[model samples]
Target: MRVALLTEGGYPYLTGEARLWCDRLVRGLEQHEFDVYALSRSERQEARGRVGLPPNVTGVRTAPLWTTDDRTLHGAGPRGGRGRGARRRFLACLAELAEVVCRGTGPGPDSSDPDDMADRFRNALHGLAELARAEGGLVGALRSEAAVRTLERACRAPGAPAAVRAARVPDLLAAAGLMERALRPLSLDWYGDGALGSADLCHATAGGPAALPGLLAQHFAGVPLLVTEYGVRLRAHYLAAGEAGLGAPARALLASFHGRLAAEVYREAALITPGNTHVRRWQERCGAERAKLRTVHPGMAADRFAEIGERGYDGRADASGTLLWVGRVEPAKDLVSLLHAFAEVRAAEPGARLRIVGTAAEGREAEEYLTRCRALAARLFPGPDPADGAHDDGAVSFEEIGGPGVPDLADAYAAGAVVVLSSVVEGFPISLVEAMFCGRATVSTDVGAVVEVIGGTGLVVPPRDPGALAEACVALLRDPARRERLGAAARARALELFTVEQNVAAFRGIYLEIVSHCPVRRDALDEAGEPVPFAHPAEAHVPGRWAASASTAEAAATPSWAGRETDGRDRLKGAAV
Candidate 1:
């Protein structure tokens, strides 16, 4: 099967969400051909270059979402002056979309009738997509003053949401710019016959912008779409909106747009795969059907941690009392709570030590958070000031995973007795899984997929509760036998459900299942435009070499059943038997 793998800011890229798993999936499924359609988040990511793709990846087409260059946008005016008719059509679709975004109440009693609102939103969104396809691109018009004015008119309309109605001229302009960027997928040339149109299936690595191309592929052609969301995109948008510093109106409008888009994508997809049940709930609440939802855990490489796992619980004398926290250092990780919790652990067990191992996430905010964490650690421990050397052998030490002390991830896990996750917000707790692979006992706050991933193998505490976190850690630290038991169980669980082999196998099965049910209906043709006989043989679906003999030039041109009265029907029946 030929699969079109759609992604945003990931896969093939050196960095971005889901890049590693996507690479693993593509490389593992060597039987299928993959054509990647990537939407880059920034010029920096594009400039950094892509990871070396496997031979199975037949082609890659990328478009940037960070900026709209003239060449990418194409013609200046709507339809290059196809006349007032085209402009009117564009205005009509934009107005419908703006109105839905301004007033649509998503999946709740807040709206008078949510189903009606959803239908309107879906119709308006598709209308715009159709227009963009017909007009070559919507970039020129979406950036025009007309689009801004239409949005302003919708905001001023009666029954508009309070936040949207509060939008001023500047806010409207910002909202218009955001919409243009988000809808840039509609202007892509990927929907052509040789691109997504030819794929047996369209697999979107995530929803939101990543799935937009797949949605269009389904719209323009009859391609089936498979959506996978590790971190719910709509949820991310809501969380980041506050940090974006946008006005109330713009945030509300964008939120509505994303919600509607997610609903539509869920409605259109043949299958929706959420990384865990936690994400599955989010999708269900946002209108995904229970029948269509499937839980596919993110795959991790277990071989890297095999050495540590095989070593068993040797009870390292120096590291026995050490507690380790491994993940990106961001405010969301809530290092403050972890530090506070460790202070209590120290009070209870004077010999206990804490090791924070991970680099801070990109941006000034993450750097500030890491700095604050170090200060708090120094104050709590009352040892050598972390400002001088944070990595010193203090009660609380912060070190990067790849540094001299910790040569790699496995070493970091090996350096500690209990793994700690203090995130107030998380998605699929990857570090927890990594710790499991290394056969280390974990104490994680109950957030996101932690409980689901842990499956009672690790201690769980409520988020932001330092006392509870400390108690859990102390309990595990004081009882080595219990820690050893949990560690063994965790490793067993991780090996069974969370390895790269399992993930690849699950997707390989899903690919065949989807195509078997919704096979692409295009007919194969010869150079003279004549229909080819037995181009897609029934024997091809069978799990054997029955169709292999047809590979010869004469057999390929004229199937063996060509001379028979019943033709391919008899052969298809024979293969079924």
Candidate 2:
């Protein structure tokens, strides 16, 4: 079977979130062929290029979402792009989409009923799809200054929100710019018969713009779509809205657009696969059918962790009652809270020590956050001889990846009986899984997929509650056998459920199942004017059973002698007649 893997802003990108998982899926399942249709979010990402690909991947097609100028589909008097008449059709589609979006905000026929809103969204979607085909694409037109002015007029029209009405010319330009990037998929050529239409299945690695191509493929080709969401893309939009980088009105509009798009994707998909139950819940909340949802944990290579876990606890838990925190140092990690909790842990148990070891990624802001965490640590636990491997106040210690005191990640977990994750936000906590793999008991905040990943294997505390975090740490610190038991269970669970082999096996079955229900058509009609069947038993294809090898070349090859003999027989029959 052949599959079209659709992705936006990731997958082929060398270092993005979904790249590794997609690479693994394609390489692990060598029985089927794959065609990757990727949508890039930025020039830099496209410049970074793709990950190493497996041979089974037959083709890779890409379109840039970075800027409209990169696309050339919108010019009038085009040399066979699209007729100038197509502009009216494009504008009509845009008007229909804007109307639907406006209604979806609160006043549509289905505003009160989610089912009704779904129907409305579908209608507008089909309209946009028709425009995509009729107009060649929206890229050229969307990039035009005229289009931005048109959108500005709509936003400032009567009944527009107070914030939207206040949007100036620059705001309209920014909004149009954002929309051009978001709707870049409308200009893609991936919807036709030789493209996504020829694939047995369309698997989108995530939602939002990445899944838009898959949506179009299904809309035009009768292809079944499978959406695998490791992180809830819509939720990320909402979170990013809080960071103050984007204008409030732009954030509002964009979030609504993404939310509606997700709802549509979920409603149309044949199946929704979430990397964990946490994401599954988000899908469910966004109108995904319960029957259509399946939870598939993200796979990790566990062989290294297996060796460490097999070694068991390196020493008695009671003797080395240290707390370990490992991951990139960022504001979300809540290192300050971790430090406060560590102070409480020290107060409760003098033997308790906290070791934080990880480098800050993402730039100067991360560096500043790390500095704040260190300063907080020093103030809480001050010491005159800070050089002597002792905390300034004998409570908390901070180090980097290869520092003499911290060494490596696995050793950091080994240094403590308890592994802690204090992040206020997360998608999936690889650190918790890593600690589990090292057979170290965990105390983690309930964020993202923490509860689901932990699955009762470790203690989960609420985020930002230093007291609860401290209590969980102190509880585990006091009980060595309980810690060992939890650690053992965690290791067993991670090995059984989260290994690369298991994830691959789950998707291999899913691919077959999806294709078994919805197969792609590659053959044209036969001379009989009937649809040609693709696969059949060899014996069934023969007259008096002339079965050949299952090779296409052998099936189509006819011997010269056989042809000559048939012609002579036909001539003899004609003469007799």
Candidate 3:
């Protein structure tokens, strides 16, 4: 099958969120031809270059979302002075979109009927998409003064929401700018015959902008769309809006836009594959059909930790009292709470130690958070004396994965008797799975997908509570047999459910199932425009000579017993014979 893989800020890029997973999927399914349509987030990410793609990837086309200029916009449509008709179309579509957004999406006194609002949003979105296609792009029009005025008018309309009604000039400007960026995908020339239109299936790696092209493909052509969301983009937008410090009106407008977009994507998809049950629930709440939802867990390579898992816990004396934490050092990881909990663990078991092994996430905020965590650790547990010719062996030590102490990821997990996850917020708890692959007992807080992933294989504690975290750690550290049993069970589960082979096999089957149910309908023609016979027949997909043999073809025309009338007498005669 020919597949069009859609992604945003990932895949093919060397540094991005799901690059590794996308690479694994593409490389594993080498039989299918893949065309990658990626949307880059920034110039630096593009500058970093992409990974070495496999031979099955036929082509790569990219567009930038970071900056918009005349070159990117191509000065088409309104920017080129396409007369009053084009201008009117742009204004009408933008107004229709703004009206739906400002009125709110739910069933409230000020909102339109739910079904009416959904249809309005869908129609307005497609109208803008068509306008972008006719004109070079919508960048110039979306940034125009008229666009801002339209939004302002809608905000002040009679039945607008309270937050939207209070929008001022600056708020309207911000909302317009955001909409312009998000809607940039509508202008891409990827819906042509040689692009997405030629593919048998369009698989969106994530929601939001990544799925926009797929939506357009299904709209313009008749391509079937398969949406996979490891992280729900709408939920992420909600979390980010709170941290963005935008005004109430801008936040409300952006939220409404994303919510509506997600709903439309879900409604139009042939199938929706969420990475876990957590994401599945989010999709269902955002208007995805329960019948269309399927949960496919993320796959990880187990070969790297194979030796360690097979070795199991050897009851090493030096590592028995150690607890390990591994992952990106971000505020969400809640390393501060981990340090505090470790202090309590130290009080309970004087010989217990904690090793934090990971680098900070890519931001000044993460670096500052890492610095604060180090300071907190120092205050809680002072370093040992150096006069005795000892190394910097403190009760708490922080090291990177490739550092001298922990040279590799598997080695890092093997160095601790119990793995610790202290995140107050998490997605799939990848590190916990890594620990499971290494056959180490884990102590994780109750958060996103933790309870689901762990499945009683490890100790669970309430997040943000140092007491519960420390108590769980101490219990695991003190009991060797229980830790061994849980570690063994965790390893067994990981090998069974989260391996790369399983992930690839699941997708391989899904690809065939979707195509079989909704086969692409393309007519074949000769150079003279005459219809070609037997271009794609059912027998082509099936095995053996069912189509080639005249006798077999005739037999397949009808059931063998179709002409014979069957009754109880026939059954009795056959039995007697």
Q: Provide the clashing-pair count of each candidate structure.
A: 0, 5, 0
lDDT of 2 by residue, 296-409 (tens): 998887776666788878665448787888888999899888888888988899878777777646668897887787677778877643224443345566667777765666
lDDT of each: 0.81, 0.72, 0.80
- What are the per-residue Cα lDDT tens digits for candidate 3 across 1-577? 7899999988889988788889999999999999999888888998999999999999988887777666644442365366576677778878988998887733454345778777777777777766666655677788889999999999898867787888888888888988787887876778767788888789999998999999878766667799988886788888877887888899999988998889899998889999888899889888899999988988999999999999988757235598989999998889889999988999999989888888645788988887788788878887762112122377877777676777788887877899999998888889999999988899999988888889879999999999999999999999989999999999999998888888888899888766665533576677999988765545236543322442332233222212211121100000000
Please give the lDDT score for candidate 1: 0.81
Model 1: per-residue Cα lDDT over 423-481, one tens digit each: 99999999999999988899999999999999989999999999999999999989988
Worst 10 residues of 1 by lDDT: 568-577
The TM-scores, one per candidate, come to 0.90, 0.82, 0.89
* Highest lDDT scorer: 1
Q: Give the TM-score of candidate 1.
A: 0.90
Clashing pairs in 3: none
